[model samples]
Structure formats: structure tokens, C-alpha cells
Target: MLTTNDLMTIDPETVTADVPLREVVAVMNRANIRQVLVVDGKKLVGIVTDRDVRLAVNSPLTTEEPLQRLELLNGFKAKDCMTSNPRCVTPETPIHKVAELLSMYKFGALPVVKDDALVGIITVTDLLNQMALIPEPKS
Candidate 1:
């Protein structure tokens, strides 16, 4: 069974709830990733994604100058924009089940936990990579 353990990224990028959104964006950009796990010492607390940042920054109700926009972003913390208590999966969870959850929830990634500690993360890209590796069976 191709479980999350087979493809989950170990020790994935994480941030505390108090971290600024600006720093969160920097981390995502630096890692070339779309999602980041929000943790409190090893416990998964929330999740921040590229989409979350976009929604927070591009709010239709707010139209601020560039400098003001920057300031607003700096003031925003991970907790202000993160999805709290996000759904998670265990390392032993089947990849297909993970895929289903991701599709159903429109989630970009799912945190992998064991013994209530953050261990890794699995994303849509990870599943796609695994799919590309499977060989086609001959008819």
C-alpha cells in the first residue's frame, strides 16, 4: 500500500501562529511551496496556503496604497489568516484516501501527524508525482 509514509515530505516547513504573514510568504517563496503547516512546538495547529495569503491581501473591501498594503501584510500574523485545526492524516494513511480528502475539501495539502506531533506533509503535487511513477499494465 502506497501510504503517506511513501511520499510525505519529512519535517516540512512550519510556522508559529504569531509569525507575520510577510515572513510566511517569504518562507513559501523560498521553499517554492504552496502550503505551510502552522505548529506549536510539534503540535499541528493550523495551515497557511498561497490561496490564503492571496485572499487576505487581495480583499475587495480594502484598497490601500502600496506602502499601506505592505504595512498591512506585516501586521497580519499566521493566525489571522490560517485555517485553524485543519484536517490531518497519519503516516499509515493510504495515498488514495489522502487524494480523496484533498479533492473533496479543495485542500492543497494535508499535515501528517503521529502521536499528536507534526511529522510531515502531503500535497496534491506529491500524489501527482507518485501517479506519474506508476507503470501502465499491459492489456
Candidate 2:
């Protein structure tokens, strides 16, 4: 059976709570990833996704209000945008169970923790790819 250890991404990009929201996104874009783990000294504090970044901008940007948009962006921080202390999974967790937790919580990914330290991350995409790797059953 496939486990989280088999599919989880090791050493995912992580940010601190005090990091500026804009910088967090830069890391996301640089990594071509949609989510980042918020950490404090190797400990998992929260999970931040592209959705969180979108949700941080509560108002629509307008050509007529460029300063206002910039002000809004500057006011946001990772701590303000991140979902703190989200549910996490372990390396031993089954991929199917990870899927269930993600579906139930509407989470984009689950932080993988071990010995109270941030280890890896399991995203829905990982689960889908794992499923795709399964060979077809004999007829």
C-alpha cells in the first residue's frame, strides 16, 4: 500500500509567520508551487496556500486605486493569512487517509511531521499522481 512517506515532498518551501505576504508568494512562484509551510525553527506552525494569498486580498484592484491596492497588500502578513495549527499527517499515514482528511477539511495539503519537526508535505496532486502510478488490474 502506498503511504505518505512514499509520496510526500521532502523539505518543502517554508516561511515564517512574520514574513511579508508578497515574499511568500515569490517563494511559491519560484518553486512553481501553490502552497508553503509556515514554520518557526523547524516546527510546523501553519500551512499557507495560493488560496490564502488570494483570500488576503479582500478588495478588487482598480486602475483608479493603485495606492489603495498596494496599501492593502503591504498590510497583509503570513501570520494574518495562514491557517494556524492545521491538522497534520505522519509519514506512516496512508495516502487514502490523507485524501480523506484533505477532502473533509478542504485543505490543499497536509504537513508531514515527525518528532515534532516539519518533515514533508502531502498534496492532493501527490495522491492523484500516486493513484495514476498503480498498474491496471488484469481483466
Backbone clash count, each prediction separately: 0, 0
Tens-place lDDT digits, model 2, residues 27-126:
9999999999999999999988899887766545434465765665678888988999989999999888999999999888999999999999999899
RMSD of each: 1.3, 2.2
lDDT by residue (1-139, candidate 1, tens digit) is 8899999999999999999999999999999999989999999999999999999888886676777678878989999999999999999999899999999998889999999999999999999998898899989
TM-score of each: 0.95, 0.89
Q: Tell me the spans in candidate 2 whose CA falls farther than 4 Å from its real position.
A: 60-67, 137-139
lDDT on C-alpha atoms for all candidate structures: 0.94, 0.88
Roughly what TM-score does model 1 have, to 2 decimal places? 0.95
lDDT, candidate 2, at 113: 99
